[model samples]
Target: MTEHDQQTDGPGQSFESVWDAIEDTPAEAANMRMRSELMIALKARIEARGWTQAEAARVMGVTQPRVSDLVRGKIALFGLDALVGMASAAGLHLEVRVSEAA
Candidate 1:
């Protein structure tokens, strides 16, 4: 891999989820995980439709800055409720599951 393309794992390489990999507290990690997943889904949907960030913002009923944040994966700038609302506005169905932790 090129220098820029190479990733140095550190200890987080052992974990599956980004939240878990960073060793966040359980609640914090779960929150971050959900935000990350929603952002990814939203970005994918926008790309699938060949929409620019401005178009995505219009469709999601959010400002362009908000769409930029979502596109850039600024997880800490969003909460679950906001993400859920955006998903709904985007006509995306979200299925939430709860299970015992491994």
Candidate 2:
């Protein structure tokens, strides 16, 4: 890679990967993506348990349509707080940790 590209990517990181680092995105966009990913993961877990959206809604205290939206990756419409609440209601605890760059 060119020196400019290496510098742009920070040290030796490459942009050739299909999806590279997005961790440094602005707060709003990062939260949006995080919420979306969490929703998808939660929906998958619910399905893996062989549960219907209606059942999941009952467990999560949300309407079935909300669960459907999550399953469909319309995550931008929901906030991280809402997702965290739903996850807890659905018997999933959200765990996150921050560490210094390694």
Candidate 3:
């Protein structure tokens, strides 16, 4: 098959695909899921405010490419610190708390 065809194969294009992608570590995945949720919430906020990606970039004080990446759900492309900064730029604050087991 050509590279172009492989690119269109999507995640589940093969029968060997498994739904339990992160079953190896539920807790880790839960933490990672936060990034997805944040992106969605922020995207909704931007949409609610009637801002285009470019406009949102301006408000976030970032380049249009950065906003495009964020809105496109490129979580792995952004580091955790960068994500927190993005939240702040979107008018939302991030609060991280860690507690030891009782």
Worst ten-residue run, lDDT, model 2? Answer: 15-24
What TM-score, over all chains together, does every model reach? 0.79, 0.68, 0.63
Pairwise lDDT winner, candidates 1 and 2: 1
The order by descending lDDT is 1, 2, 3
Q: How many residue pairs clash in each candidate?
A: 0, 0, 0
Identify the leading candidate in terms of TM-score: 1
Report the C-alpha displacement of residue 102, candidate 1, in angstroms.
Answer: 2.2
lDDT of 3 at 87: 74
Residue range 1-102, candidate 3, lDDT tens digits: 421122224565432112114335545554565666677777888889999988988887878898888888887776666667777988887776677632
Worst 10 residues of 3 by lDDT: 14-23
**Residues 1-102 of candidate 1: C-alpha lDDT, one tens digit per residue:** 421232436864544555664645878868777887899999989999898988889988999999999999888899999999998888899898999987
After the best TM-score superposition of candidate 2, give how far the Cα of residue 39 lies from its true spot, in angstroms: 1.0
Over 4 Å off, model 3: 1-27, 97-102
> Which digits, one per residue and each the tens of the lDDT, describe model 2 over residues 1-102?
431232236676654221224445445545655676678778878988898989988888999998888888785578888998988877776788766632
